[model samples]
Target: MSVQALVRWVAAGLAALVVSAMPMAASAQQPSKSSMALANEILDIKGSLQIFETVIPGVVEKSKATLLQMNPNLFKDVDAIGNDLRKEFAPRLAVLREEIAKIYATRFTEQEMKDTIAFYKSPLGKKILTEEPNFVDRSMAAAQDWAVKLNDEVLQRFRAELRKRGHPF
Candidate 1:
């Protein structure tokens, strides 16, 4: 795939991952009876999983933006594409949520999940949860810039060594 396409794919994957890793709230209203039970709490009914809620829609928006950039004329109907994208992906959300929760259930003990939930409900935890998307966006940009610079430096050295050995790209 083209670099832009790969980057967009990776960005969307990372966004979904980060959202999945987010701890569920442990407030009294959002308490979980068990780890298994917690695993089933895809949403807490009061918009508690706001971050999770954003994953699909955010990805859809990003996909639309990338398509527009790639072929502005062809994708001039961005709203139509965006709607179709949402329709295509919306059905798979439950499966994704179940898989994420299953992974969480395996990785965390009942008490640990509870503790994590509690932590996320606290002031500092809530702040972190709320700001995670912004953090991820800035970090991804910085990392991509660094990777491009580092890749160029490394490739220059490698190509020079290869040319010295009578090989060229």
Candidate 2:
């Protein structure tokens, strides 16, 4: 997959995991430090925080692509600039991680976060961690195939309706 596509897929997968793991209702009060710590631990166990690692690089790559498209002659300069920007923005990844953890902290109680961490560290959780990517990939492919078939069915129905109206073309 292209870098951009891979980045998008990772981001979607991360979002899905986070949403599924969090509680439906968020706390009105600020998250406690203990809850935040547990939330960070949950992220670490799931390796979800790693998803944000690509954000800066992806942005740099897209910017580089756009600049190159505008002035192909500056390819070398653009590459250098992109590399510099990646390093400069790398630290911002921590901010994203903190924000994600805060969301988790607010959505789940400290006890719940602790239980989640325990579950993730178990054998079943390890198995899930290993297998989820494959499952998601296959599921996405199946959905795409289904959509293609649905599109064909819809088109056929549209044609039938047009024919009934004496406007088949």
Candidate 1 per-residue lDDT, tens place, 37-90, comes to: 765542342123433555677789888888888888866589787888788888
* Residue pairs in candidate 2 whose N, alpha carbon or C atoms collide under 3 angstroms: none
Model 1 lDDT, full chain set: 0.64
lDDT (0 to 1) per candidate: 0.64, 0.80
Writing each residue's lDDT as its tens digit, candidate 2 over 70-154 gives 9999999999988889999999988878877888887788888988998888999899988876676666768778999999999
> Candidate 2, which segments miss by more than 4 Å at Cα?
1-8, 14-28
Provide backbone clash counts, one per model: 0, 0
Candidate with best lDDT: 2
